[model samples]
Target chain A: MKISILRKKLDDKEISAVELTRLYLDRISAADKLTDAYLYVNYDGAIKAAQSAQTIIDAKQSRPFTGIPIALKDNLCTFDMPTTCSSKMLDGFVPPYDATVVAKLRGQGAVFLGKLNMDEFAMGASTKTSYYKKTKNPYDLTRVPGGSSGGSAAAVSVGLCAAALGSDTGGSIRQPASFCGITGHRPTYGFVSRSGCIAFASSLDQIGPLADTADDCAALLTATAGRDIYDQTTADKTFDLKKSDKGIKGKRFGLIKELMGKEVDKDVSAAVKKAAEWFINAGAVVEEVSLPMLTHAVPIYYLISSAEAASNLAKFDGVRYGFRPEKTLNFFDMISKSRDEGFGWEVKRRIMLGSYALCSGYYDDYYKRAIKLCGIIKSQYAEAFKKYDALLSPVAPTTAYPFDKLPDDPAQMYLADICTVSAALAGLPSLSTPCGYDKDGMPIGLMITGKRFDDAAVLSAAGAYEKEFVRKPPQLKGVSEMKL
Target chain B: MKSDISIKWLGNLSKIKFDDDGLKKMAADMQSIMTLMDSLLLVEPVEFEDGTEFCGLDALRADTVRDSFDPELLVSQAKDSKDGCFVIPKIL
Candidate 1:
């Protein structure tokens, strides 16, 4: 259900938070068998939290997101559950504190359903790398729901939960949300506090929400997006929920010339072009712009993110926090054995590449040059932003593909992120809204991006475009409007 | 593929141990990924200073002591601990 409509229902006492929580929990239980979306279901904790939300609602103290059941991506630290990052290294490890986003959402009375699966340590483009079961797209069971926020997207798309929180680093959230046909937002870097979030790539990672509509993501950000003293990198400006008309008139949108090329599936490209055309018809100027450096986004992203990840993941050495081997002949042996047994193949591979990139002889050649190229890519987007109010593109080159059709090489999967990474590298705000379906009956995503710190405007433009998007997947079309 | 010695050295530096097959597979994977990254060198070089300054950092907070987590709380999370300290095998 949409948060705004549900808020009124909750406040009027037509439905208690406890009842709403039960409905979502039941849905998750029914959906889990098919989607493998949730890694852990915190039934007892959710019930207790819902009862508290009920008390707040009865007293007429409810907030925008109060009483809503929201699923958390496994990477967010929660004192009530294990924050595994879908990797065995942290299996069964419960954090003593909540992540900044969790702390904020809890203050607003949001119900926690459970933790959702993701790429192990948020490394891969597909949830196939998750330590738990792989999540499949709800539309077609044979195809993948993109990752590493695959579970978050799938759960939200299928109504397993009212909404969900997912982290984006190099398209983890947006790509999956596109594949699952839900709304996903990636706040500009530093806009959302990252404290207590298990770091994959500290510089690039930002947590946001995936839900039924752009307004819902905006509301989620209003509650959770802001600075935290704990995370020095958080931006100084907090997200304000002042309601604007969010009209599309008089805005200029850019369609990157490089992004519309042959790599994109014709269906996917056409759907985005149709969205651009909609803006044009709505009294907005639509122009084709150039960002040639975007072609280098994938390679540079790997170098920088991997380098940071290698350093960030070093803390999981079995000495403190997470899993540890039972036997060891020496201290070094203990750390080595724990990591070897605990991490999955993808996690280990990333650590290997990161170590190589940051190593003594290779540091300047690979890591340093990539950082320089990343700067050029950032300016390239910035240069376009100077001429355009917002930008548009396909979230990925194609819709969800069948698992058997995916390439054997990991690099091929990395290449799939070609369209989404440049925005991340540039630290710009971006989102993916379901535009239309392909001939194969899979959903295609239309991505909208704006300048750094121009997040609210970005969301407003998407919310304006979302009017025509009320046409949802056949299964989910009327689910949000269904009376409890 | 990376040289056998270099691959072994990287594993050691990263504190990871892989079997011979895992090592060979990882080396091959890294070689292919590196080949893709090689294209970045041809992009026109630009200036960028290496630092966290690009990310907006909040001004430093007051230095006054405040309520803090007990050391034992962190130690309790360790896989093995005793007497408020993490227990590990002897290095020597």
Candidate 2:
């Protein structure tokens, strides 16, 4: 059930917080065997929190997210649960304090369902690299749920939780949401605090929400966003959460041409076209706009992201809180063996590439140049937003692919990030919602991006399309019904 | 493009080792990718200061600990803890 539906049920006293939590836990028990969405479920702690919330509800003290069950991506530090990031590196590491987002969600009396799985250290586009089992697409068990927020998306998609929090460095949330056919919102950079999230790329990371609907995502975003003393990068401005049906009357939307090329799957293009038609029919003006820098976005994103990742991951030595190798014949051996044993192949590959890019003699030629290119891309997006109220595109080239069908070449894997990287570079707000399905009955998503800090407009436009669009996925057909 | 720079140098700085074949393959792959990225050089040069940039680090406030927990609590989570400190293999 959606967050709003749960809120209504709670308000009507039809279900207590403890009851709702048990119902979701039961649903997860029934469904997550197929989806593999959670890395750890905090059964006792969640039950305690739900009982506390029940006490508050009995006393009629209701908070915004009171009694709503939410899932956290494993990268976010939770004081009471293991935050593994689906990696052996942090297998037994548990923080003594909660992430700022987790603290806020708890303050609102939201029940923490569990820590969901993710790409190890939030590094990969698919959760297959996770040391834990792969998160299966809720839409089709044989296919991958996209990552690094794969489990977060899958949990909400399969109704294991009311909503989920995910971190998006480069389409981690939006891409997975699209693959799962759910609504995911990546708020403008600094809109949500990142104090306790395990760092991927500090400058690019933002925590977002995945839910069944745009309105639900908006509510969760509102609850989680705004300034935090611990997170100096968080914005001081507040996001207005009440759904305003600002019908897209005379709003200018640019359909990014670079995102709709021959590389995109035919069904994805059709879904985007249908979304554009819905916008036009709703009285918004649609025009094709060029973002030439977008052609190089995937490469630029990889270079910069890897460089940042190299520095961020240096903390995972055989020291302090993480996994350590028992064979410490020497210090170097200790570090090497710990990393080799703990990290997956994909994580090690990026760390190596990133270190190489940021190394002396090559810094100016690769890392510095990529930063300059990022500046250019940011400006290009600014120029486009000046001409358009928001931009529209396909969230991914295609829907979820079968688990074993992915290409062997690393560059081909990187190519999967093609359409979603530009907004990430600009640190702009974007949303993905189900628009249509392909012949295989897999869902396709339409991405809507707004100017930086214009999260409301992005959500409003997405909500408008959601209300007017005709081709939504049919009622919850569980994974067993999928052809694959 | 510098001949003096070898995969050994890169690997040393990165703290990871690769087989000779892996080094050669990665170098060739990265070179081809970088060559394609050379297209960005064709864009008209604009004054860097004139462009809209992200809100700078200047906007950030000085670091102040908003909340402090017992350091022992943090040390307790470490795999190897001794004398209220995280123990690591000697690097020196």
Best by TM-score: 1
Q: For candidate 2, write residues A1-484 as lDDT tens digits.
A: 6677778788789888998888888777777887899989878888999999888888888787988899999999998898888889999778887898899989989999999999999988778888988888866788889989999998888778889999999999999999988899999998898989999988899999998888888888888888887777777777775654465799999999999999999989987998899888889999999998788888788878888988888888767778786766777877766776777767766776687678777776767777887888888888898899999999999899998997767777887898888899889999999889898888898999998888888898888777766544333444332110
Backbone clashes in model 1, listed as residue pairs? none
lDDT of 1 at A90: 88
Across A1-484, the per-residue lDDT of candidate 1 in tens digits comes to: 7888888889988889999999888877666788889999989999999999999988888888788899999999999898899988988888888999999999999999999999999988778889878898888888899999999999988888888999999998899999998889999898899998899998899999999988899889889877688888887777764564457789889998888899999999999999899999989999999998888889899989999999999998998888888877789988888888999988888888888889887787789988888888877777787789899999999999888887777678788999899999988899998888999888889999988777877788888888876545525322343348
Clashes of 2: 0
Q: Under CAPRI classification, how is model 2 graded?
A: acceptable
The per-residue C-alpha lDDT of model 1 at residue B48 equals: 52
| Candidate 1 chain A: 10-residue stretch with minimal lDDT | A474-483
What is the Cα-based lDDT of residue A14 in candidate 2? 89
The DockQ for candidate 2, computed on C-alphas, is 0.42
- The parts of candidate 2 lying over 4 Å away from their true place are A243-245, A470-484, B1-5, B17-56, B60-67
RMSD of each: 2.2, 3.0
